[model samples]
Target: RTLTGHESVQPQTSREMLSSGHWLIPTIGGDVWLERPPPPMWWIGIVYTVTGVKASDSIARLAAVLAALPIILLTVGIAKRLFGKGVAVMAGLILATMHEFYSYAINPEADIFLCLIVTAVLALFVSMEFPHVRTTGAVAGSGKPSFFGTRPWPMAGFFLLLGATNWAKGLLFGTVMAAAPIVLYLLGRALQERSFHPLRPYLWCWGWLIAGAAALAWPVAVIGQYPEILQLWQEHYLGRLHRGYLREPWWYYAVQVPYVLLPWTLPALVGLLCSARAAWQHAGRERFICCWALSAPLLLSLADGKHHHYLLHCLGGWAILAAVGLAPLWGWLQDKLRLIPYSAALGAVAMALLAGTGGILWYSRIPGRWGTIVGAVVFISLATWVILTACQQHHLLRAFVGILAPILAAYWLWVPYQASYLDDYKEDLVFLRGAESLIPNDVPVLVQYDWTAPLETFWVLYHMRRPGVLIRDPWQAAEKTANGGQNSSTAYVLARRLDLPLYRRAGTVETVLESTRTRGEKNPDQRRVLYRIHFTQPLPPAPEDYLRVVRRTLW
Candidate 1:
């Protein structure tokens, strides 16, 4: 953290903004710079407003807590339609109370938005079958969703919104999401004689709506902002997708699924295996949903570029399938393992009771934090009751993750306070801010490596500006140091602790900012070590970036 009070750490994107804090507005005659994600997906500004504290605190992540309710209600309703009310409630509760999703959601990340959107899409797909039935007493829709017409407009609208949001996040799940409606429409066509006829006109409408929505939200090609429409489109969407060439193992997402869907939800994988035959024989709505659920993650699984959050939108889809898989296994387990669920519950109850007792002893010392105690008592009592009353049929893993649900709920809520501790690194950020205050605001700054992340996001949004150049290789960094012309400017160096000695001896430099290591994370041998060393000499200003970053953020 390199800012005021160390409440949050500096991510590269946000840091770039800090250098240009003097200019928060883009004037008519000034240069126009399109940021990576204009008004980010997670609404970091909203997060900044709420906690009134920057850096990394649990307090700012209010989005997930508020979103949990809808995720629970919608998933439950879908599960009820597919399984039964009994499993529906359990499924909904399991998801609403899931610790895994909660962990990913509360971080100032885009997954929560994806999580809710995917869940809604999945639930809506399921509702296409039994439109008349109301699971959570929510509004009911027609059996066939009218995405193409007035009736289907809502679903179509949702798809468009979600589709753009997906693209904003590097088009993370774009291919998969785009394929869903096509597949659904295709399958629906095979069954029914006519569906959204005149494929040409229908495609026209689809293209217009999707494109219009994208143009409105995409910062790079903000419609009227530029006259070179096609050129800008290619650069923003197509170019961005190919630029970030970080390679990941192909099987990354597939391998993590077991862990993410842990304990109760893991066995649900069997349902996916069975769904193939089930879909072939039935071709029912459930079958359509089975395809929809797997499509997004399946595509992500195959992509050369991959990240864990890429398939987050599928969490709800996976949960629904997990419900289907578990509902059956839950029954079989009752007879076979008679005592397993109870064993797990007993273990949970004992743990909770012990915790509650511990709370009683510690409450005096930690008075205001009793929300912790109250939360523990409620969930533990609830779990004990479920264990005592959940007559025979229940998935053991489900029951375990379920019992631990309240504990995690308490943890997510309590841990945000510790974001303040996470903010400890912010002092370094403040030092950077202080440095910016001293230097001539108009002077261009050269960042020696690829500097982009949460910090950069903040700096950009706040309208801070600086000419941030990325000198990727050691040779590039070395070159600027070797040529100390008067035209040269300041360059920041990122290097490891061990290399600091070597760099200082070799070059004129100022300011070395080290990042607090992510717990258990160490500097990669290849990743330029994290020290932010400002070089005395800057490389010759390149025509493209020399003045642009500085002009935007400063006078």
Candidate 2:
């Protein structure tokens, strides 16, 4: 359950910011981390100060949890406006229970916040531009006045939210993601309506001028202090776009759609087809939702840098579309199965539950998991029964509950089970914790690792609870240990076991700790060893390496 990979960056940066009192600029290992903006770190810092809690994985993730609430509400609002209440509930539940959304909901990262801001922006834009059109009935001017009132105020709110996306990430990534769909929807609407009216407002809106100024405020303020950020921004943006950083084929996101949507994949696919058909036939909410759902993936695929989490911002559209797809399917099931007896339905449900329970007991042979198994089975059965009983007459909602309840229960059970028993990074954690216990607080730790694995070095430093220097070139190990001293001094160096001979050439190396792998494990790349290096004599200086300091911004 320890934070690994990019998850460690949030707390590490937050800790650095709080300790250094540098809220405007985020630093890691006493260096300005220009890779991301400060909003996520600021949110974590606020949570820590208000709750008096130390920075940990759970405390840091609380910020993500808070950010996800608005996304659900906004999705429900959009769905309710577009379809009816039934579809609204389905959309909300689909988004809340999605595997990808759940994964990012608990992760302390900026993607979820970006998704929140983007969803709000899109919802505000839709409410302003499109009247509410229900599937069963059409209402004229059903777009209710927002809290800021009608006309230019709501427009201003939309632009402001779009501008705030910069704070969520950096370099206008969110702005691009939010704007693409809006432009596409407007173009599509203009073509459908056979007029240039929809395009006019977007071009002449005064709110965009204010929003542009507001969006530039953060970058301008930061650049005024550290002008080098301009270069960093250029490199970061251009590198990701054209320089092949984490490059993937255009079909990468297309392939990941099913996995991202999980249980609703089939429904979403159906809904996407339905939306396309509806859009082709007439200009309505389907056209907008289709644009919203498809724009992110299509636009992101153009970038060389592609990640599965990058699509998180567009999940609301997919969720609503899935609801749209489910409504008709639900109606068909109701009509076809109406003649079935309640006793037969209950019997089938019981049999399916029993089969699932048997599989769980059979497969999960881990010790001390019986309690979770029993608890899950009991809770799922009781909850399913209550839901079925309450909505027995309404076949559509009952069917949804039947499909959704078990998945939710299983997810609830899996969290504790995975946290307690499943740890893929246990070897690294064990080695780091062992090194922390063996090494003295005053003794500086020099992590001698190849420049390729920044996450490993970051994991060590974050858990070690001290700033350490990185010696990417093994030849500099002795020079680092000497610390410009001719007298005797000791420092611990962490290196792979395979690279022990290289460090032994630098100084007197004594193995202090070693990471152990499970039996039959064939991967030798991760076998790390901590060595206590003693410097009796000064060593010659080596040429500077590009990665001498521990940089946490690589990810």
Candidate 3:
């Protein structure tokens, strides 16, 4: 799939960095774009350099996948440290198969990278502080705890990642997301233990100085170059805390939790309930995992800004909790089904798998999809036979295999199919390519668009390989292209057909290139036109516009 929406930002900025040879500051359309920190761009740049391949969308997305692999391993390690090995395996599977996590794994966005770093930081903190927590039937830890509850290496790694969170997202957002949970867990521990011992590790860790230094490095360097960026940074970071940006209701995240968790929603809720009960009785790993899981969503809910992707940071904790809830349920199924015959259970499972496969094949009877249908059928049949053969020794094994096999198959088959099918929804890149061929490389292009709809402009800048400037107001474009203006030499404006009248009012507009394409399944008549504007006279100040009002209202 082509990069669309904000996903284009990653490769666009990386290309700029490589072309301009300015790694410290990232640029988009030849303008410094400090809205996002430079780590994801740096990762993409590194991938381009190491592979010696042209920077394509696929290669850029590969960087995100590489970053996500560590998150899965870290989730497994964290679960193993808190629960037993059984729960660890289950937790890793749940996280890896989750729809949101899988979507972001290949997406060229900073959220997945942020999630990786945050998970690492919390995992190290758990290993350090709760190294010897007692589980249901076993104790989980590497060995006896060393000084400060961990050795020097892990302590240094924890502080380093904790500070590196700033680079993942920004100076304030990542640090707050990581630290809030630690503070909550420590407060809970202090209340339960009736001592200040839980706070000792934080006080003694002077490696925080290293973390602080690392976090401040980029901000200080960028601010030194452009002091005005300090104000922009404040508006971008601190402004989200109030009711000005992406404001949703207080219970927004609560409503989204079930959808995000998908198949594990009920199990995660049960696990959360069990952990809450356990924490009420004692201070242990349950409390720590609970804090890790709930802290970010709770804190983000309090703030006005909310988006579904922000919940990625909390997925690790929820996956572990789902495992915690699923382990006993597996045992319960074994005990409850002892009276049922083994042949009867296997027959029932086989019948259900056949029915599901038959229904899918019936529904997806397209001419070209027959290959995929046959493959899915054969895969399901083999998987069912293998499960039945392997679990003949024990009913408990049969029950576990029965529950997990379908999920694995869906992750391998259905997810990819859905992604491929949805790739046809947005045709921005197709139209932008058509428009790109019409405009010369030497001519400057100004993308006239509303502030809210910058995705197409970003697409032009990235795919067209031109220094495109986004102008929210038509007057801005006229001012730039007016006689004796800075950009008066052969400038063109790319805008939608609906917005052509507004641009015409600002100047004498000539249609250079007009293209029409379906935006998505719902909006099939989308049209875009490139216009060469010749400013005849200076336009007076315009009245208040609806787009400007909406932009101000939101920002």
- Choose the strongest candidate by lDDT: 2
Model 3 gets an lDDT of: 0.72
List candidate 1 segments past 4 Å from native. Answer: 1-36, 39-42, 47-56, 67-69, 80-84, 97-100, 121-130, 134-163, 170-172, 178-211, 214-252, 273-277, 339-555
lDDT of 3 by residue, 472-510 (tens): 666766655554255563458777766777766666778
**How would you encode candidate 1's per-residue C-alpha lDDT over 4-64 as one tens digit per residue?**
2111211222333433441222211123333333333235444444666343334434544
Each prediction's whole-model lDDT (CA): 0.48, 0.73, 0.72
Query: TM-score ranking from best to worst?
Result: 2, 3, 1
Best by TM-score: 2
Q: Which stretches of candidate 2 lie over 4 Å from their true place?
A: 131-151, 204-206, 221-236, 242-244, 335-393, 444-450, 465-488, 498-506, 518-522, 545-555
User: Could you tell me the lDDT of residue 62 within candidate 1?
Assistant: 55
Clashes of each: 43, 0, 0
**Model 2 root-mean-square deviation:** 5.3
- C-alpha TM-scores of all predictions: 0.59, 0.81, 0.79
Query: Which model is ahead, 1 or 2, in terms of TM-score?
Result: 2
lDDT agreement of model 1 with the native: 0.48
On a 0 to 100 scale, what is the lDDT of residue 517 in model 3? 63
- Model 3, poorest ten-residue lDDT window? 136-145
